[model samples]
Target: MTNLYRAGDLRTPDALAKVTPEQAGWTYSGMEVFDLAAAESVTRVLDGIEGVLVPLSATDVTVTVDGDRHRLRGRVGVFDAVSDWIYLPLGSTVEISGASGEVALCSSRAEVRHEVAVVAAEDVPVEVRGSGRATRQVTNIATPSSFEGADKINVCEVITPGGNVSSWPPHRHDGIGDCEPVNEEIYYFRMGQDDSSHGHPNGLGMFRVYTVDGSSDETCPIFDGDVYLIPEGYHGPSIALPEYPMYFLNVLAGPLPERTMAFCDDPAHHRIREEWTDEDQDPRLPMTSAESRVS
Candidate 1:
Protein backbone atom coordinates (compact mmCIF):
# COMPACT_ATOMS: atom_id res chain seq x y z
CA MET A 1 0.00 0.00 0.00
CA THR A 2 2.97 2.36 0.58
CA ASN A 3 6.49 2.67 -0.87
CA LEU A 4 8.67 4.75 1.42
CA TYR A 5 11.33 3.68 3.97
CA ARG A 6 13.63 5.53 6.34
CA ALA A 7 17.28 4.59 6.78
CA GLY A 8 17.08 3.10 10.27
CA ASP A 9 13.76 1.43 9.50
CA LEU A 10 15.18 -0.92 6.89
CA ARG A 11 16.95 -4.15 7.80
CA THR A 12 20.70 -3.85 7.75
CA PRO A 13 23.38 -6.33 6.85
CA ASP A 14 25.49 -8.06 9.43
CA ALA A 15 29.10 -7.06 9.98
CA LEU A 16 29.84 -8.51 6.54
CA ALA A 17 26.81 -9.00 4.21
CA LYS A 18 23.05 -8.42 4.28
CA VAL A 19 20.18 -8.88 1.82
CA THR A 20 17.69 -6.00 1.78
CA PRO A 21 15.06 -6.82 -0.90
CA GLU A 22 13.04 -9.33 1.08
CA GLN A 23 13.28 -7.04 4.09
CA ALA A 24 11.67 -4.27 2.03
CA GLY A 25 8.90 -6.58 0.80
CA TRP A 26 10.55 -7.15 -2.55
CA THR A 27 11.64 -10.32 -4.29
CA TYR A 28 15.04 -10.88 -5.91
CA SER A 29 16.20 -7.24 -5.64
CA GLY A 30 18.17 -5.15 -3.11
CA MET A 31 21.63 -4.02 -1.98
CA GLU A 32 23.84 -5.19 0.86
CA VAL A 33 26.05 -2.58 2.50
CA PHE A 34 29.08 -4.15 4.16
CA ASP A 35 31.80 -2.54 6.18
CA LEU A 36 35.36 -3.76 6.54
CA ALA A 37 38.41 -2.63 8.40
CA ALA A 38 42.00 -2.55 7.18
CA ALA A 39 43.05 -6.03 6.13
CA GLU A 40 39.68 -7.55 7.06
CA SER A 41 37.44 -9.79 4.91
CA VAL A 42 34.19 -11.76 4.64
CA THR A 43 32.82 -14.40 2.31
CA ARG A 44 29.37 -14.61 0.71
CA VAL A 45 27.92 -17.44 -1.34
CA LEU A 46 25.56 -16.73 -4.24
CA ASP A 47 23.47 -19.74 -5.07
CA GLY A 48 20.75 -18.44 -7.43
CA ILE A 49 21.47 -14.72 -7.72
CA GLU A 50 24.13 -12.31 -8.97
CA GLY A 51 25.91 -9.55 -7.03
CA VAL A 52 27.48 -6.26 -8.05
CA LEU A 53 29.93 -4.69 -5.60
CA VAL A 54 29.92 -0.88 -5.85
CA PRO A 55 32.56 1.00 -3.97
CA LEU A 56 30.88 3.54 -1.70
CA SER A 57 33.95 4.72 0.17
CA ALA A 58 36.57 2.10 -0.31
CA THR A 59 40.13 1.98 0.87
CA ASP A 60 42.76 -0.45 -0.39
CA VAL A 61 40.40 -3.39 -0.96
CA THR A 62 39.99 -6.42 -3.20
CA VAL A 63 36.91 -8.39 -4.20
CA THR A 64 37.59 -11.97 -5.21
CA VAL A 65 34.87 -13.20 -7.52
CA ASP A 66 35.08 -16.95 -7.77
CA GLY A 67 38.85 -17.11 -8.22
CA ASP A 68 39.63 -13.73 -9.74
CA ARG A 69 40.87 -10.94 -7.52
CA HIS A 70 40.02 -7.31 -8.32
CA ARG A 71 41.66 -4.31 -6.67
CA LEU A 72 39.67 -1.26 -5.49
CA ARG A 73 40.38 2.43 -5.13
CA GLY A 74 39.29 4.44 -2.11
CA ARG A 75 36.71 7.20 -2.28
CA VAL A 76 35.82 9.71 0.38
CA GLY A 77 32.16 10.15 -0.47
CA VAL A 78 29.60 9.19 -3.09
CA PHE A 79 28.97 12.78 -4.23
CA ASP A 80 32.53 13.48 -5.42
CA ALA A 81 33.80 9.94 -5.71
CA VAL A 82 34.39 7.98 -8.88
CA SER A 83 32.82 4.59 -9.73
CA ASP A 84 34.15 1.05 -9.46
CA TRP A 85 32.15 -2.17 -9.37
CA ILE A 86 32.80 -5.91 -9.24
CA TYR A 87 30.23 -8.20 -10.83
CA LEU A 88 29.52 -11.64 -9.37
CA PRO A 89 27.81 -14.30 -11.42
CA LEU A 90 25.37 -16.85 -10.07
CA GLY A 91 26.62 -20.03 -8.37
CA SER A 92 29.81 -18.33 -7.35
CA THR A 93 31.52 -17.52 -4.09
CA VAL A 94 32.76 -13.95 -3.51
CA GLU A 95 35.30 -12.94 -0.89
CA ILE A 96 35.59 -9.23 -0.13
CA SER A 97 38.11 -7.62 2.20
CA GLY A 98 40.52 -4.71 2.38
CA ALA A 99 41.98 -1.75 4.22
CA SER A 100 38.72 -0.07 5.21
CA GLY A 101 35.47 1.75 4.25
CA GLU A 102 32.13 0.49 2.87
CA VAL A 103 30.70 -1.09 -0.29
CA ALA A 104 27.19 -1.83 -1.54
CA LEU A 105 26.59 -5.35 -2.79
CA CYS A 106 23.68 -4.88 -5.21
CA SER A 107 22.00 -8.18 -6.03
CA SER A 108 19.09 -9.65 -8.03
CA ARG A 109 17.90 -13.15 -8.76
CA ALA A 110 19.40 -14.42 -11.98
CA GLU A 111 19.06 -17.71 -13.82
CA VAL A 112 21.90 -17.07 -16.23
CA ARG A 113 25.45 -17.09 -14.91
CA HIS A 114 27.30 -14.47 -16.92
CA GLU A 115 31.04 -13.85 -16.92
CA VAL A 116 32.46 -11.84 -14.02
CA ALA A 117 33.61 -8.34 -14.95
CA VAL A 118 34.94 -5.49 -12.85
CA VAL A 119 33.87 -2.08 -14.08
CA ALA A 120 36.48 0.45 -13.12
CA ALA A 121 35.48 3.86 -11.84
CA GLU A 122 37.10 5.71 -14.73
CA ASP A 123 34.87 3.90 -17.22
CA VAL A 124 31.58 4.99 -15.64
CA PRO A 125 29.64 7.39 -17.88
CA VAL A 126 28.14 10.24 -15.91
CA GLU A 127 25.62 12.54 -17.60
CA VAL A 128 23.24 15.36 -16.74
CA ARG A 129 19.51 14.77 -16.81
CA GLY A 130 16.82 17.50 -16.93
CA SER A 131 17.64 21.19 -16.73
CA GLY A 132 17.47 24.06 -14.20
CA ARG A 133 16.17 22.96 -10.81
CA ALA A 134 15.52 19.45 -12.02
CA THR A 135 19.11 18.99 -13.12
CA ARG A 136 20.95 15.99 -11.63
CA GLN A 137 23.96 13.88 -12.45
CA VAL A 138 23.40 10.34 -13.72
CA THR A 139 25.92 7.51 -13.71
CA ASN A 140 24.78 4.65 -15.94
CA ILE A 141 27.21 2.02 -14.76
CA ALA A 142 25.43 -1.32 -15.15
CA THR A 143 22.34 -0.53 -17.11
CA PRO A 144 21.22 -3.07 -19.72
CA SER A 145 22.40 -0.68 -22.43
CA SER A 146 25.71 -0.18 -20.70
CA PHE A 147 27.06 -3.34 -19.07
CA GLU A 148 26.53 -6.73 -20.60
CA GLY A 149 27.82 -9.00 -17.88
CA ALA A 150 24.68 -9.04 -15.77
CA ASP A 151 21.69 -10.96 -17.13
CA LYS A 152 18.88 -9.50 -15.00
CA ILE A 153 19.83 -6.23 -13.33
CA ASN A 154 19.60 -2.61 -14.51
CA VAL A 155 21.43 -0.41 -12.00
CA CYS A 156 22.10 3.33 -11.98
CA GLU A 157 22.44 6.28 -9.61
CA VAL A 158 21.34 9.92 -9.52
CA ILE A 159 22.88 12.87 -7.72
CA THR A 160 20.79 15.95 -7.00
CA PRO A 161 22.38 19.02 -5.48
CA GLY A 162 20.96 20.79 -2.46
CA GLY A 163 17.49 22.33 -2.92
CA ASN A 164 16.98 20.63 -6.29
CA VAL A 165 14.71 17.98 -7.73
CA SER A 166 15.51 14.93 -9.84
CA SER A 167 13.50 11.87 -10.96
CA TRP A 168 11.09 14.49 -12.15
CA PRO A 169 8.06 14.31 -14.54
CA PRO A 170 6.59 11.39 -12.56
CA HIS A 171 7.31 8.19 -14.45
CA ARG A 172 6.71 4.46 -14.03
CA HIS A 173 7.97 1.21 -15.57
CA ASP A 174 5.12 -1.08 -14.67
CA GLY A 175 3.65 -3.67 -17.14
CA ILE A 176 4.90 -4.36 -20.63
CA GLY A 177 3.92 -1.99 -23.40
CA ASP A 178 5.56 0.43 -25.84
CA CYS A 179 7.75 2.04 -23.18
CA GLU A 180 6.62 0.14 -20.12
CA PRO A 181 8.67 -2.71 -18.71
CA VAL A 182 7.14 -4.71 -15.87
CA ASN A 183 9.92 -3.92 -13.42
CA GLU A 184 10.32 -3.30 -9.71
CA GLU A 185 12.69 -0.64 -8.42
CA ILE A 186 14.55 0.18 -5.21
CA TYR A 187 15.96 3.59 -4.26
CA TYR A 188 18.86 3.62 -1.77
CA PHE A 189 19.57 7.15 -0.66
CA ARG A 190 22.77 8.88 0.57
CA MET A 191 22.66 12.51 1.62
CA GLY A 192 25.50 15.04 1.66
CA GLN A 193 26.36 17.51 4.41
CA ASP A 194 24.33 20.70 5.02
CA ASP A 195 25.54 22.76 7.95
CA SER A 196 22.87 25.32 7.11
CA SER A 197 19.94 22.89 6.94
CA HIS A 198 19.71 19.97 9.41
CA GLY A 199 21.63 19.62 12.61
CA HIS A 200 22.27 15.92 12.07
CA PRO A 201 25.62 15.02 10.62
CA ASN A 202 24.31 12.26 8.36
CA GLY A 203 22.19 14.65 6.12
CA LEU A 204 18.56 14.72 4.86
CA GLY A 205 16.39 14.59 1.70
CA MET A 206 12.84 13.73 0.49
CA PHE A 207 11.01 11.57 -2.08
CA ARG A 208 7.39 11.30 -3.29
CA VAL A 209 5.32 8.37 -4.58
CA TYR A 210 1.83 8.87 -5.99
CA THR A 211 -0.38 6.34 -7.78
CA VAL A 212 -1.53 7.04 -11.31
CA ASP A 213 -5.05 5.58 -11.16
CA GLY A 214 -5.96 7.29 -7.85
CA SER A 215 -4.94 4.24 -5.88
CA SER A 216 -2.54 5.84 -3.36
CA ASP A 217 0.18 8.46 -2.79
CA GLU A 218 2.62 9.69 -0.18
CA THR A 219 5.78 11.75 0.31
CA CYS A 220 8.51 10.48 2.61
CA PRO A 221 11.48 12.03 4.33
CA ILE A 222 14.93 10.67 3.30
CA PHE A 223 18.14 10.68 5.24
CA ASP A 224 21.47 9.04 4.67
CA GLY A 225 21.11 5.24 4.32
CA ASP A 226 17.34 5.24 3.55
CA VAL A 227 15.90 2.96 0.89
CA TYR A 228 12.45 3.11 -0.82
CA LEU A 229 10.59 0.55 -2.85
CA ILE A 230 8.51 1.31 -5.96
CA PRO A 231 6.26 -1.66 -6.55
CA GLU A 232 3.67 0.25 -8.62
CA GLY A 233 2.70 3.87 -9.35
CA TYR A 234 3.84 7.26 -10.72
CA HIS A 235 6.84 8.36 -8.66
CA GLY A 236 8.98 11.41 -8.95
CA PRO A 237 10.23 14.87 -7.95
CA SER A 238 12.67 13.59 -5.31
CA ILE A 239 13.93 16.58 -3.38
CA ALA A 240 17.33 17.34 -1.88
CA LEU A 241 16.82 19.34 1.27
CA PRO A 242 18.23 22.86 1.34
CA GLU A 243 22.05 22.87 1.50
CA TYR A 244 22.22 19.04 1.43
CA PRO A 245 23.05 17.15 -1.74
CA MET A 246 21.25 13.87 -2.41
CA TYR A 247 22.43 10.63 -4.03
CA PHE A 248 20.35 7.53 -4.73
CA LEU A 249 21.33 4.16 -6.20
CA ASN A 250 18.56 2.60 -8.31
CA VAL A 251 18.29 -1.20 -8.54
CA LEU A 252 15.85 -2.52 -11.17
CA ALA A 253 14.86 -5.95 -12.48
CA GLY A 254 11.93 -7.68 -14.14
CA PRO A 255 10.76 -10.82 -15.96
CA LEU A 256 12.58 -9.94 -19.18
CA PRO A 257 16.13 -11.05 -19.89
CA GLU A 258 17.13 -7.81 -21.59
CA ARG A 259 16.92 -4.90 -19.15
CA THR A 260 16.22 -1.23 -19.86
CA MET A 261 15.43 2.16 -18.34
CA ALA A 262 12.27 2.78 -20.35
CA PHE A 263 9.24 4.22 -18.58
CA CYS A 264 6.00 6.17 -19.17
CA ASP A 265 5.98 9.78 -18.06
CA ASP A 266 2.75 10.91 -16.48
CA PRO A 267 0.87 12.70 -19.26
CA ALA A 268 -0.58 15.29 -16.90
CA HIS A 269 2.90 16.44 -15.88
CA HIS A 270 4.68 15.66 -19.13
CA ARG A 271 4.44 19.30 -20.19
CA ILE A 272 6.85 20.26 -17.44
CA ARG A 273 9.58 18.27 -19.15
CA GLU A 274 9.49 20.51 -22.20
CA GLU A 275 9.03 23.72 -20.23
CA TRP A 276 12.64 23.56 -18.99
CA THR A 277 13.94 23.37 -22.55
CA ASP A 278 14.94 27.01 -22.54
CA GLU A 279 16.90 26.93 -19.31
CA ASP A 280 20.51 25.89 -18.93
CA GLN A 281 21.58 22.89 -16.89
CA ASP A 282 22.22 23.72 -13.26
CA PRO A 283 25.83 24.71 -12.62
CA ARG A 284 25.88 22.67 -9.46
CA LEU A 285 25.48 19.44 -11.41
CA PRO A 286 28.13 17.02 -12.69
CA MET A 287 29.47 17.12 -9.16
CA THR A 288 32.44 14.85 -9.78
CA SER A 289 35.16 13.94 -12.24
CA ALA A 290 33.45 10.63 -12.81
CA GLU A 291 30.96 12.55 -14.99
CA SER A 292 31.54 12.08 -18.72
CA ARG A 293 28.88 14.25 -20.50
CA VAL A 294 25.32 15.52 -20.55
CA SER A 295 22.35 14.84 -22.81
Candidate 2:
Protein backbone atom coordinates (compact mmCIF):
# COMPACT_ATOMS: atom_id res chain seq x y z
CA MET A 1 0.00 0.00 0.00
CA THR A 2 1.16 3.55 -0.61
CA ASN A 3 2.23 5.24 2.62
CA LEU A 4 3.00 8.84 1.81
CA TYR A 5 1.45 12.30 2.03
CA ARG A 6 1.43 15.07 -0.56
CA ALA A 7 2.33 18.70 0.23
CA GLY A 8 -1.36 19.53 0.19
CA ASP A 9 -1.96 17.16 3.10
CA LEU A 10 0.52 18.83 5.40
CA ARG A 11 -0.94 22.30 5.27
CA THR A 12 -2.41 23.53 8.52
CA PRO A 13 -4.87 26.41 8.65
CA ASP A 14 -2.21 28.42 10.43
CA ALA A 15 0.26 27.77 7.64
CA LEU A 16 -2.12 28.90 4.90
CA ALA A 17 -2.74 32.32 6.47
CA LYS A 18 1.00 32.85 6.79
CA VAL A 19 1.82 32.39 3.08
CA THR A 20 2.32 35.41 0.82
CA PRO A 21 1.11 35.77 -2.77
CA GLU A 22 4.50 35.08 -4.35
CA GLN A 23 5.26 32.25 -1.95
CA ALA A 24 1.79 30.78 -2.34
CA GLY A 25 2.25 30.89 -6.09
CA TRP A 26 4.75 28.02 -6.00
CA THR A 27 3.27 24.52 -5.95
CA TYR A 28 3.75 22.10 -3.08
CA SER A 29 2.71 18.84 -4.77
CA GLY A 30 5.10 16.18 -3.39
CA MET A 31 5.16 13.44 -0.77
CA GLU A 32 6.18 13.39 2.93
CA VAL A 33 6.14 10.62 5.55
CA PHE A 34 7.83 9.13 8.62
CA ASP A 35 8.83 5.73 10.14
CA LEU A 36 9.02 5.61 13.91
CA ALA A 37 9.49 1.97 14.86
CA ALA A 38 13.15 1.35 14.09
CA ALA A 39 16.26 0.57 16.11
CA GLU A 40 17.22 4.22 16.56
CA SER A 41 15.60 6.87 18.75
CA VAL A 42 12.54 8.48 17.20
CA THR A 43 14.02 12.00 17.24
CA ARG A 44 17.14 11.03 15.27
CA VAL A 45 15.13 9.00 12.74
CA LEU A 46 12.43 11.65 12.37
CA ASP A 47 14.91 14.44 11.76
CA GLY A 48 15.16 13.97 8.02
CA ILE A 49 11.65 12.64 7.29
CA GLU A 50 10.23 16.06 8.20
CA GLY A 51 9.30 16.51 4.56
CA VAL A 52 10.19 18.94 1.70
CA LEU A 53 10.31 22.69 2.40
CA VAL A 54 9.49 25.09 -0.51
CA PRO A 55 10.11 28.80 -0.06
CA LEU A 56 7.84 31.34 -1.76
CA SER A 57 10.07 34.42 -1.48
CA ALA A 58 13.39 35.83 -0.36
CA THR A 59 13.69 36.23 3.42
CA ASP A 60 16.24 36.18 6.23
CA VAL A 61 16.37 33.17 8.62
CA THR A 62 18.04 32.49 11.92
CA VAL A 63 18.48 28.94 13.26
CA THR A 64 19.42 28.84 16.94
CA VAL A 65 21.04 25.85 18.57
CA ASP A 66 21.91 26.10 22.27
CA GLY A 67 21.80 29.90 21.89
CA ASP A 68 24.35 30.05 19.01
CA ARG A 69 22.57 31.25 15.89
CA HIS A 70 23.24 30.42 12.23
CA ARG A 71 21.65 32.71 9.66
CA LEU A 72 20.15 31.86 6.21
CA ARG A 73 18.97 34.38 3.66
CA GLY A 74 16.34 33.09 1.15
CA ARG A 75 15.91 34.56 -2.31
CA VAL A 76 13.48 33.61 -5.11
CA GLY A 77 14.12 34.29 -8.79
CA VAL A 78 12.04 36.45 -11.07
CA PHE A 79 9.75 34.85 -13.66
CA ASP A 80 11.48 33.87 -16.96
CA ALA A 81 14.78 34.11 -15.16
CA VAL A 82 17.36 31.44 -16.04
CA SER A 83 16.54 29.45 -12.89
CA ASP A 84 12.77 29.43 -12.53
CA TRP A 85 12.77 27.88 -9.06
CA ILE A 86 14.73 27.68 -5.80
CA TYR A 87 14.82 25.15 -2.91
CA LEU A 88 16.11 24.50 0.63
CA PRO A 89 16.34 21.18 2.55
CA LEU A 90 14.07 20.04 5.40
CA GLY A 91 14.96 19.74 9.12
CA SER A 92 16.36 23.24 8.76
CA THR A 93 15.28 25.12 11.87
CA VAL A 94 15.17 28.69 10.65
CA GLU A 95 13.48 31.44 12.65
CA ILE A 96 12.07 34.41 10.73
CA SER A 97 14.49 36.68 12.66
CA GLY A 98 12.69 39.61 10.98
CA ALA A 99 12.07 40.21 7.31
CA SER A 100 8.70 41.37 6.19
CA GLY A 101 9.10 38.36 3.78
CA GLU A 102 7.44 34.95 3.92
CA VAL A 103 9.00 31.45 3.76
CA ALA A 104 7.12 28.15 3.77
CA LEU A 105 8.54 24.80 4.86
CA CYS A 106 6.83 21.43 4.35
CA SER A 107 6.41 18.86 7.10
CA SER A 108 8.60 16.40 5.19
CA ARG A 109 11.82 14.94 6.57
CA ALA A 110 14.11 16.98 4.29
CA GLU A 111 14.19 20.05 2.03
CA VAL A 112 14.57 20.39 -1.81
CA ARG A 113 15.18 23.38 -4.07
CA HIS A 114 14.48 23.67 -7.79
CA GLU A 115 17.09 25.03 -10.21
CA VAL A 116 18.56 27.27 -7.49
CA ALA A 117 22.29 26.94 -7.94
CA VAL A 118 25.79 28.20 -7.27
CA VAL A 119 26.11 29.13 -10.97
CA ALA A 120 23.94 30.46 -13.78
CA ALA A 121 21.49 28.03 -15.43
CA GLU A 122 22.92 28.85 -18.89
CA ASP A 123 26.43 27.90 -17.84
CA VAL A 124 25.45 24.55 -16.34
CA PRO A 125 26.38 21.74 -18.75
CA VAL A 126 23.67 19.74 -20.46
CA GLU A 127 24.19 16.02 -20.99
CA VAL A 128 22.25 14.10 -23.59
CA ARG A 129 21.70 10.52 -22.54
CA GLY A 130 19.70 7.57 -23.86
CA SER A 131 16.80 8.88 -21.78
CA GLY A 132 16.81 12.55 -22.85
CA ARG A 133 18.66 15.81 -22.21
CA ALA A 134 19.61 16.88 -18.70
CA THR A 135 21.21 20.06 -17.36
CA ARG A 136 23.19 19.14 -14.25
CA GLN A 137 23.50 21.95 -11.66
CA VAL A 138 25.60 21.48 -8.55
CA THR A 139 24.00 22.32 -5.19
CA ASN A 140 25.87 23.38 -2.04
CA ILE A 141 24.12 22.24 1.13
CA ALA A 142 25.45 20.74 4.35
CA THR A 143 22.93 18.08 5.39
CA PRO A 144 22.43 14.89 3.41
CA SER A 145 25.14 15.75 0.86
CA SER A 146 26.15 12.79 -1.37
CA PHE A 147 25.90 9.03 -1.86
CA GLU A 148 28.81 7.62 0.07
CA GLY A 149 28.24 7.30 3.79
CA ALA A 150 25.00 6.92 5.70
CA ASP A 151 24.21 10.28 7.20
CA LYS A 152 21.29 12.59 8.01
CA ILE A 153 20.16 12.69 4.36
CA ASN A 154 21.01 12.36 0.62
CA VAL A 155 19.97 14.79 -2.13
CA CYS A 156 20.38 14.88 -5.94
CA GLU A 157 19.04 16.14 -9.25
CA VAL A 158 18.43 13.65 -12.07
CA ILE A 159 17.51 14.88 -15.58
CA THR A 160 16.23 12.29 -18.03
CA PRO A 161 17.25 14.02 -21.23
CA GLY A 162 16.91 11.50 -24.05
CA GLY A 163 14.73 8.76 -22.56
CA ASN A 164 13.24 7.44 -19.34
CA VAL A 165 15.14 6.41 -16.22
CA SER A 166 14.28 2.70 -16.41
CA SER A 167 14.79 1.91 -12.74
CA TRP A 168 14.34 -1.73 -13.64
CA PRO A 169 14.98 -4.78 -11.49
CA PRO A 170 12.63 -4.21 -8.57
CA HIS A 171 14.28 -3.84 -5.16
CA ARG A 172 13.66 -2.89 -1.51
CA HIS A 173 15.67 -1.55 1.46
CA ASP A 174 14.38 -2.15 4.98
CA GLY A 175 16.37 -1.93 8.19
CA ILE A 176 16.89 -5.67 7.88
CA GLY A 177 18.63 -5.30 4.51
CA ASP A 178 21.32 -2.87 3.34
CA CYS A 179 19.40 0.39 3.90
CA GLU A 180 18.94 1.89 7.32
CA PRO A 181 15.64 1.56 9.17
CA VAL A 182 12.70 3.92 8.61
CA ASN A 183 14.31 5.51 5.55
CA GLU A 184 12.07 7.78 3.48
CA GLU A 185 12.47 9.34 0.03
CA ILE A 186 11.00 12.17 -2.06
CA TYR A 187 10.87 12.78 -5.85
CA TYR A 188 10.05 16.27 -7.11
CA PHE A 189 9.51 16.30 -10.88
CA ARG A 190 10.19 18.84 -13.58
CA MET A 191 8.33 18.56 -16.93
CA GLY A 192 8.49 15.52 -19.19
CA GLN A 193 9.54 15.94 -22.85
CA ASP A 194 7.36 17.12 -25.70
CA ASP A 195 8.29 15.95 -29.21
CA SER A 196 10.07 18.94 -30.71
CA SER A 197 13.78 19.40 -31.33
CA HIS A 198 13.83 17.58 -28.01
CA GLY A 199 11.53 14.54 -27.57
CA HIS A 200 7.94 13.59 -26.70
CA PRO A 201 6.40 12.57 -23.38
CA ASN A 202 5.54 8.91 -23.84
CA GLY A 203 4.31 5.88 -21.93
CA LEU A 204 3.54 5.59 -18.26
CA GLY A 205 6.45 5.29 -15.79
CA MET A 206 6.07 3.64 -12.41
CA PHE A 207 7.41 3.54 -8.84
CA ARG A 208 7.01 -0.08 -7.64
CA VAL A 209 7.11 0.34 -3.88
CA TYR A 210 7.14 -2.58 -1.43
CA THR A 211 8.36 -3.61 1.98
CA VAL A 212 10.25 -6.80 2.76
CA ASP A 213 7.12 -8.16 4.40
CA GLY A 214 5.51 -8.21 0.91
CA SER A 215 3.37 -5.17 0.03
CA SER A 216 3.50 -2.97 -3.07
CA ASP A 217 1.89 -0.82 -5.79
CA GLU A 218 2.81 0.89 -9.12
CA THR A 219 2.55 4.70 -8.88
CA CYS A 220 0.59 6.46 -11.63
CA PRO A 221 1.94 8.65 -14.50
CA ILE A 222 4.42 11.06 -12.87
CA PHE A 223 4.59 14.29 -14.90
CA ASP A 224 6.32 17.66 -14.77
CA GLY A 225 5.99 19.67 -11.53
CA ASP A 226 4.74 16.51 -9.83
CA VAL A 227 6.15 15.19 -6.57
CA TYR A 228 6.03 11.53 -5.43
CA LEU A 229 7.08 9.68 -2.29
CA ILE A 230 8.76 6.40 -1.33
CA PRO A 231 8.83 5.67 2.41
CA GLU A 232 10.26 2.24 1.57
CA GLY A 233 10.60 0.04 -1.52
CA TYR A 234 12.45 -0.66 -4.78
CA HIS A 235 12.17 2.46 -7.00
CA GLY A 236 13.73 2.75 -10.47
CA PRO A 237 15.14 4.12 -13.64
CA SER A 238 12.32 6.64 -14.13
CA ILE A 239 10.72 5.55 -17.40
CA ALA A 240 11.28 8.12 -20.16
CA LEU A 241 8.79 8.40 -23.01
CA PRO A 242 10.26 7.08 -26.24
CA GLU A 243 10.25 10.67 -27.52
CA TYR A 244 11.28 13.01 -24.69
CA PRO A 245 13.02 13.05 -21.35
CA MET A 246 11.48 13.12 -17.85
CA TYR A 247 13.23 14.83 -14.96
CA PHE A 248 13.20 14.86 -11.13
CA LEU A 249 14.84 15.77 -7.80
CA ASN A 250 15.44 12.96 -5.32
CA VAL A 251 15.83 13.56 -1.56
CA LEU A 252 16.44 10.69 0.88
CA ALA A 253 16.81 10.46 4.65
CA GLY A 254 16.52 8.27 7.74
CA PRO A 255 17.68 8.08 11.35
CA LEU A 256 20.61 5.94 10.33
CA PRO A 257 21.56 4.65 13.71
CA GLU A 258 24.09 3.21 11.28
CA ARG A 259 23.62 5.83 8.52
CA THR A 260 23.97 3.59 5.44
CA MET A 261 22.18 2.20 2.33
CA ALA A 262 23.42 -1.36 2.60
CA PHE A 263 21.05 -3.41 0.49
CA CYS A 264 21.01 -6.28 -2.02
CA ASP A 265 20.55 -5.21 -5.61
CA ASP A 266 17.44 -6.37 -7.41
CA PRO A 267 19.01 -9.42 -9.08
CA ALA A 268 17.58 -8.54 -12.50
CA HIS A 269 19.62 -5.42 -13.22
CA HIS A 270 22.18 -6.42 -10.64
CA ARG A 271 24.78 -6.73 -13.36
CA ILE A 272 24.04 -3.14 -14.42
CA ARG A 273 26.19 -2.12 -11.47
CA GLU A 274 29.30 -3.57 -13.10
CA GLU A 275 28.97 -1.18 -16.05
CA TRP A 276 29.00 1.88 -13.81
CA THR A 277 32.09 4.08 -13.52
CA ASP A 278 33.02 7.33 -11.73
CA GLU A 279 34.09 9.18 -14.84
CA ASP A 280 33.91 12.98 -15.20
CA GLN A 281 30.28 14.13 -15.40
CA ASP A 282 28.82 13.43 -18.86
CA PRO A 283 29.49 16.67 -20.82
CA ARG A 284 26.00 18.27 -20.79
CA LEU A 285 25.63 19.71 -17.28
CA PRO A 286 24.38 23.31 -17.51
CA MET A 287 25.77 26.20 -15.40
CA THR A 288 29.34 27.60 -15.46
CA SER A 289 31.20 29.63 -12.83
CA ALA A 290 30.72 32.82 -14.85
CA GLU A 291 27.04 32.21 -15.63
CA SER A 292 26.10 31.52 -12.01
CA ARG A 293 27.41 34.88 -10.93
CA VAL A 294 24.96 36.86 -13.10
CA SER A 295 22.91 37.91 -10.08
Query: TM-score for each prediction?
Result: 0.90, 0.50
Give the winner by lDDT: 1
Runs with alpha carbons beyond 4 Å of true place in candidate 2: 4-151, 166-171, 177-182, 192-205, 242-244, 261-263, 276-295
lDDT of each: 0.76, 0.37
The TM-score between candidate 2 and the true structure equals 0.50
Instruction: For model 2, give the 10-residue run with minimal summed lDDT.
Output: 35-44
User: What local lDDT does model 2 show for residue 116?
Assistant: 16
Q: Write the per-residue lDDT of candidate 2 for residues 25-128, one digit (tens) a residue.
A: 22222332211111121121223433223222333444332234544443331111122112333333323232433333333333332221222233323333
lDDT tens digits, residues 91-196, model 1?
8999998777777788888899898887777887878889989998888879877798887887888888888999898899877345557678888888888522
Clashing pairs in 1: 38-99, 83-121
